[model samples]
Target: MDGLSGQGPAAADRADTAIRAIGLIKDFGDTRAVDGVSLAVPRGTIYGLLGPNGAGKTTTLRMLLGIIDPSSGSRVVLGHDRPIDAAPQIGYLPEERGLYPAMHCREAIAFMGALRGLSLPEGRRRADALLAEHGLGEWARKPIRTLSKGMAQTVQLLGTIVHQPRLIVLDEPFSGLDAINQARLEEMIRTKAREGATVIFSTHVIAHAERLCERIAIIAKGKVAFEGAVDDARAKLRPIVRLRTRNADGPWRSAIPAGTRTSGRDWEFELPESGPEPLLRALIDGGAGIETLAIERPGLHDAFVAIAGDAAAAAMKQEVPQ
Candidate 1:
């Protein structure tokens, strides 16, 4: 296995790597869908590929899954040099969902397992158990068309994992699901990772990545803007201080940072290098009549805006109608 730095993996890390893509590029005519993207997903971890629509997230996933070949670069999946060589050990749920409309839920799931070499009988058994576990026991025998969109999507996901692949890849797995189903899927993802399967999912929704990802790669305009631990991303930006004071012209205003901005009586600014405690004491001592004050640490959303810039983040937000 190769490390993220393009070197041989260390002894302690060799066995922990599940997926590694280095300088992956994909071109469609004049456009480059994925531009020299590189990522390493560790085993038993939930990694997220985050970007707005047309940001090349899907293209990169496809290349990693061997559904499409990259114009250049290399990837290793589950110790295999090529993704197809490790296909049986990988479960992939594409962004575009598809299932036989006339097939029974159990049969559909079993068929998916069969593709990964599970026996029909065992596949059916596992499918039934999985359905029961996911609160769809009664729907096992029902036709796919009979289930709601959420239920069908759930069935598709169950099929993807019925064979217990060592690595699971989901492209836009959260698309179109309501809040409840989204939460359910989140739990399922956590469960899979807990069971020691590496899970990689792509989404434009910052909330999902913030909630579920230990590591994430933020893609913008077909380029990876940031990739690393979620905490590291958030750490790149300073904490914000929001305050509302009755005495807007008080001497304590000097405590505000140089780049501070005001909205009516409210003042919002990044904390200074000296931190917020000094400013708080200054405001109190100067009789600034503070009505409210808060120091907020930046989250993944703020990190995205900071790293990808306001224009790209705005474009991403607008891309997802959800």
Candidate 2:
């Protein structure tokens, strides 16, 4: 892909969000799960909270949702200083699955809706509608125990949004979902955002962020390693381009250009800061069949590796002090 200029939105168009957390810290006994983390989520966009399992993603969400209080620091969700007071405007789907096993799907979902202040009739109506929308209409009366894991997860997801909260926090919303269901969930999220709700979710899956999130906050070792637009995050990475050709082993191997290197058919390379047009022309002149040429901005996974690797190396160096 030819270098496309800043793709998404103008700087001014970037929505000004109200999620602010200053030195937010949460601990579990001797373990510090969230260590002085701060973040700002823009309004009217999909934000992703990403990290490996046991990396405090769940703990952080709990703190934000008022299910657990922070050990220290402060947080303001949708301008509400008190997290509990912010509950009415926030919808949270927890990491752990929980629905009354004995209750019918619609009833269980409606009950969750009630917790968000929806009345019985209103909750039931929405529950019935979402059950059908999510393809669980036929199973609406089935007990939670009788539903498949995917089905129950769908019900739980419906419960999260049934009351139409202004901000939706989904914890591993794609977990246990097959590709088809995952696609459906992704579509659901996009639709929700198009309808003007700010959706933030936590995931270990990086591609989800690449595809859907407008902004991402990546946490490693209980701290944020990076937070910004996907393109901006990628831009911070050293420039590398990937190219594919008709011949895997070609003469180009011996004639590698400066700021470039070859690895079989693949290359981890860059061009002169001046421009890439010359190099682009050189490949064509060399009879090298260029099937695909992509100017790569390192992805979230690459950034994760670079950031976490550096941190680990620094920690190891500290441990070995002279």
Question: TM-score: which candidate is best?
Answer: 1
Model 2 clash number: 0
Model 1: residue 214 alpha-carbon error in angstroms: 0.9
Question: Which ten contiguous residues of candidate 2 have the minimum total lDDT?
Answer: 313-322
Off by over 4 Å in 2: 1-15, 243-268, 281-294, 310-322
Q: Which residue pairs in model 2 clash with each other?
A: none
Clashes of each: 0, 0
Return the TM-score for each candidate structure: 0.93, 0.82
The candidate maximizing lDDT is 1
lDDT of each: 0.91, 0.79
208-294 per-residue lDDT for model 2 (tens digits): 877999998888788987888887777667666678777765555544456666666767676446456766776777767888887
Show pairs that collide, candidate 1. Answer: none
Q: Can you give the lDDT of residue 117 in candidate 2?
A: 97
